[model samples]
Target: MQTASGDTQSRLPDTIVDESALDELLSRPSPALQSFIKTVSSPLVILGIGGKMGPSLAALALRAAQAADHPLEVIGVSRFKGDGARPWLEKHGVKTISCDLLDAEAVTRLPEAKDVIYLAGLKFGTAQNPSATWALNTLAPARVCERYSRSRIVALSTGNVYARNEVSRGGSIETDPLTPLGEYANAAVARERIFEFHSRRNGTSVALLRLFYAVELRYGVLVDIARKVHAGEPISLATGSFTCIWQRDANEMILSALALAASPPAVFNLCRPEIFSIRQVATRFGELMDRPPRFMAVETGLDLLGNPKKVCDALGQPPVTLETMLRWIAHWVTTGGRNLGKPTHFEVRDGNY
Candidate 1:
């Protein structure tokens, strides 16, 4: 498969042997990203840098800056409660500031930056403690938007904000309704609303990216399916189709999205344009891992999917192909590679989690 940039799938490594290699792969900046970094101003502040995608994202921005010789200072802010992401970011030359975004005063103390990437949001434990999820999703954005009222902010939202769409209808577009099920999804909508409100009121330039899923070798929809196949576990097909982009591609586009920020916040669905079938992907993982995948549920034909045409038109289609991702994930699973133990729960049809 050829990427939007004309690069072929053969350029990707056959197998990521370990975490070191995986980190390097995820943080590697593309040529387009390097050029984009040149246009970004110094002191790029990335909020919630302790999350799964945050460390590598901060590193990717720093790497792009280095490649472009832009002399950029990448600052990552998060509640660094012995998460180890702080040290990893520090090792990558990203300045780390420990701050709880829920505290408005601390948010004000954050260093000024013309460009900010908001990654702070809670999702996993929403079922148990919906209040925390709501507070984090709603409060953090309010504080950050207030603190960075004049900055260009690229906030990461989720595809969960939209209800599941018919498989034949492609996927949900940006203008689709935000009527989703479950507390987590609703909270995500609130996060976007807060950013939109602040942008409109303060004339803040903001870009809200509704990302479907970002897959790397460790933990994602692909890894979930691959591990199920490798472990002889049943792969659920209740949620038939899904969408994902390589983490590197997602992070690069996220950084590039700073250019898309505008008053009232420009919205874009972030994912590969192609919709992936759960059965097809699981079966392919079975083939790659030399294990037959077990099936449990039937396909509902409705899923939480996103169409990336708008973002792809703005920033080129993600370079990593589904086949490449499947191959890499299967290899990692069979080799007993370490996983984050966090399942994407992509099969959930009710938006729970």
Candidate 2:
């Protein structure tokens, strides 16, 4: 993926945080984002904004509003167990609010906004604590939707809502039947239903974005694989294929989806519009890192994949490409770039995440 400047390597430095590279990347405004900013009113509330992608998404909204010359308030809501995310978001002109969405009173007290982005959910560790996963995924959305029933909401969802598919068929489309495995995936389905029910009952505009995986320098499927390869660990090919999008690309898409929210709650799969071979991607990473790629499992034909044709047609191809992201990830990892220590369990097939 060639960067916006077409010089992929020279632009991205080793220190993403110290130099505010992530801020710059996330805040870069495009036509779609600028247009979305103009359509919505002030005070866009991003619920559950403490997750891996929440801060950047909130900052992106703030910057886009600024760039559009229609500056509006952007508030980030989260438990904020620590001060790290709050400080960064506050510094970026996003109002930070520490509110646990699980608490009904806390949600009721939340300042209402015209636009809301739902990024809160639990995925990993669902095997042990299934109740928490269900509660976070289902109950949280119910509270958010009930509180802001009239706001145009772009809720984040997971592609895991769809069962595994073969790489040959281009992956699952939005209209495909959802037969997701595991408690977490089922919980995700319930989350969408809650949002849909609210949309129907209250005429709240809703858009559910089912993302496969998002990759960046610090944390993502690519980063996880790169770290494993760097540690001389064997890459698993059990789930042979996957779909992913660059972090900024995914964030931008999420922002743009605000414009696509409908009364009946539209569904869009958020990912690169192509199926990627794990072996091929890992081998490419190995070649870039000058490390021999090690493989450990037989390629299983079934895997979680998504068809982003609808979104691609609506928003066009993401600015960054898979190849460009690989180059960036390779450079970042080789030069001792930081990882968020959050591993995406892309290898898990039994829905036991």
Candidate 3:
């Protein structure tokens, strides 16, 4: 793991890293991303840019092109319902397009671009509205693929598509059989299949990024644990261990995937190579917050983990390590940090989101 600047570590303040500051940090692209951006063209369109990962990712793409001395028009597409995500992205020089991906005509009318990053999908409200989840997860991908059939696409996928793997075996690889547990996981698998089907039929180049939890101070597994620990609540260990990457790392790798797109869509697991234990993560958060972490469950054999060796080999590992994220998140949570009100539901052992 890459060590972050010790100066930044030593000077950590006792306050929440505000939204703007965190966004700026996440938008800073790595050296690998800059080199990869040199190979791509302008007018890159990112669908579903309103999501947690999308805004920074869109910003990262724009920054990478600038750093590489390339002029690029980066467009972020979303419904623009609320959350100020659209405005924030636009402020970072990302062209904003308001369109609901579910509306087929709206999707068809979207501008043609040389590259596409599909980040649109449903996950959080799967249990109550399974139909909506299926529609967005599977149907939306099909529509996006059809609209940009010829363009090189890098679609965001979830690690939940794979069955829980034993901890000793490390994590699930790209080729592992997907035996996802609930409606949400199954729908995610369907999402991948839809993209694969279209990529095969239209001869479109595609890359499926199977990413686990991507963490920042705002949301993700690390935030969930940090929040719980800071509040002096007991953390659950039902899921045992999991994998995650910093938001900056995930954003850079997602942009780099444009170079890996293939006619027969290639799959790559996106997460830190290490499998992190929930108890240890919680305990670390406790230490940072001056509170002892309370545990509620035993470590199970099953865990939602992924093997990111392929992506690490291709795009290089993230500069921010898990320990770095823990330190950042701990400080953020202990000092009245704001959450995006989204939970990872990492406690779900039945695979239900």
Candidate 4:
């Protein structure tokens, strides 16, 4: 692993045995992250800390703070709803608050902080109840921006905001249009627009990160492919290529991006620079799990992808590689490791999810 000060270290585990081990791995801060945490002020507020990536991200920030011996207090706010994330975050020394972001008064009553990380958004089930998705994706951000107008905010957005592009073009750059396909994607664009409006109006410094995917052992694009291959299900190649960053790397970059926040709201596409072929990834998983993979559909030559050059130039390339991720995910799946059962639905070109 590469530290923020540009030092090299070996931290990758051979295999993740269970959730405990997996959480530790995900929450472990890299040297780069530890170094960055020192610069952050106390009471780093993380909104929507009850989602799939929230607990580990909060833990990573806390671990980084501890490593730097910085007196940084990490507070995570979410409705929680009895999810296992609240307990895990509390156990990791992150202060937890149960509050619905949609309640304007509830958001106003939250503690104050100069630095904030926004992670709340709805993607799946958008087709079933799009009004809920729009309210959460658009309204919640509006409230957060209004409350944290003076804070340096790092907000999570999705690459689904971009229209499909040719594979030969590498991927959609940060300047690409936001005319994406479905309700979920349009709502995501509205989320970004809301943040931008608030930032411009209030002179708030903000960074918008359009992340493609964040992969880990339990659930992600990698796990989705690995499970299908292991079960001998036909994999689709219609959306032939995509991009992702390891969850840890994504968390670290998101924290580090606090420095990139600015008036007018700097935007960056967050993911590994390399474009990955779905067919190749499935075949690699098969080799690792000793299973022959089945495939269906053909490459459409158009897919939703992101170009990470801007962010990679600002922060270094993510240290974790594709081979390491494949090895870790394959081992976890074959060993009866637990899965979150939440598919990424990466193949959905219609942007339904």
- In order, candidate lDDTs are 0.90, 0.84, 0.85, 0.91
lDDT of 2: 0.84
Runs in model 2 lying further than 4 Å from the true structure: 1-19
Top candidate when judged by lDDT against the true structure: 4
Model 1: number of backbone collisions: 0
Candidate 3, residue 79: the lDDT equals 89
TM-score for each of the candidates: 0.97, 0.94, 0.94, 0.97
lDDT of 3 at 304: 79
Across residues 87-118, which tens digit of lDDT does each residue of candidate 1 receive? 89999999999999989888899999999999
lDDT of 2 by residue, 181-285 (tens): 999999999999999999999999999999989887888998888877777899899988899998878888888888889989999999988788889888898
- Tell me the number of clashing residue pairs for each predicted model: 0, 2, 0, 1
Q: After superposition, how far is residue 20 of candidate 2 from its true place, in Å?
A: 2.2
lDDT of 2 at 253: 85
Residue pair clashes in candidate 2:
1-323, 1-324
* Off by more than 4 A, model 4: 1-9
Error of 2 at 161 (Å): 0.3
